[model samples]
Target: MDRLLSIEPLSAAAFAPFGEVIAAGAALQRFAINGGTTERLHALARARADDGDVVISLALAQARQFPFEISMLERHPKGSQAFIPLDQRPYIIVVASAPTHQPHAFLATQGEGINFRAGTWHHPLIALQDSSQFLIVDRDGPGNNCDEIALQPSWWLTGIDAG
Candidate 1:
C-alpha cells in the first residue's frame, strides 16, 4: 500500500548492490572558487555515531537563490548509502535502496551534475537545474543513523531525455 517509483540513471552496473556513485573531485566544504578559496570535494562515505550527540549542516547551495531543502537524514542499521547533488555545475546523483524492489519512480539530471549512494531513497532538495553545490555526510552522534519516511503518495523524478 506504498509503492511509487521514478528515479533512475545510476551506473556502476546500475549501482552495484547500491553503493559507490563517485565524482565531486575538488571544491567542497561550502564550495568556493574565484576569490574565496575553499576546496576539498569528493566524499561519499564517512560516518561516525556510537552516540555522543551529533547534528551538523553546512551550506553553500545557491541556484535560484536558496530554495533547496532536505531535512537531515542518516541511516545504516547495517545498511547505509547516499551521494547527493543535482546542480552546482558539476553533475552527480546516486541514491541507493533496492535489494528486492521498492523503486517505482525517481529521476535525476539537469545541470550541476548529480551524486547519491548512501541509504539512497531520495526526494529531498532535488534541484533540476541551476542551483546546487552541496556537501552533506550523515551519521554523527546520539544513536545516529537517522530515519524518516514521510511520503504521501506523491513521488516523481522520471528519466530525463531517456538517455
Candidate 2:
C-alpha cells in the first residue's frame, strides 16, 4: 500500500530543517533601493555551490495532476537549488530528510519561493498550472552533482485541490 502524504502550508519555521524559505515579509530585512523605488528583501536565501560556480537558468514545467505519485527524489550533493516562480502560480514541494527519508509536502503559494540546502532530497518541480515558468539558480559545473533514489512502494500525495 502506498503511503499518504499530508500537504501543509509553506512557512519558514516549518521548512527550516530542509532549507530556507524565499519570500518577502515584514519580518525579513528590507531596504529601499533604486532611488527609493524598489523595496529589496535582502538575502532571503543564499545559494551554495561546493565545487563549481552558481548559475541561473529558466525552466518550463508541465502541470502535474494530483494524488501525484512520488516515486523518486533527487538531491544536489555539491550545491543548493532554488526555484522562483515566474508566473506567480501555486505549486507543490515534496522533500525528505536523511536516514529515514520520510517525505513531507508543502504548498507554495504565490510570492513564495524556496531554496533547498545542499544534499536535501526533493522531488522535481510540481507545477499546478500548465506551462509554468520558473527561474532556477544552482551550480553549473562538473562532477555529477545530482543524486537520485527510487522510493519503494511510492507515496501518494493527495489532499490538495489544484483548482
Q: Considering every candidate listed, which one attains the maximal TM-score?
A: 2
Q: Judged by lDDT, which candidate is best?
A: 2
| lDDT tens digits by residue: candidate 2, 12-34 | 99999899988885137888999
| Reference-based lDDT, residue 103, model 1 | 39
Candidate 2 — which residues are off by over 4 angstroms? Answer: none
Query: Model 1 — TM-score against the truth?
Result: 0.25
lDDT of 1 at 93: 41
* Candidate 2 residue pairs in clash (backbone atoms < 3 Å): none
After superposition, the stretches of candidate 1 with alpha carbons farther than 4 Å from their true spots are 1-50, 59-75, 78-98, 104-126, 133-138, 141-163
Give per-model TM-scores: 0.25, 0.94
- Measured with C-alpha atoms, the lDDT of residue 108 in candidate 2 is 92
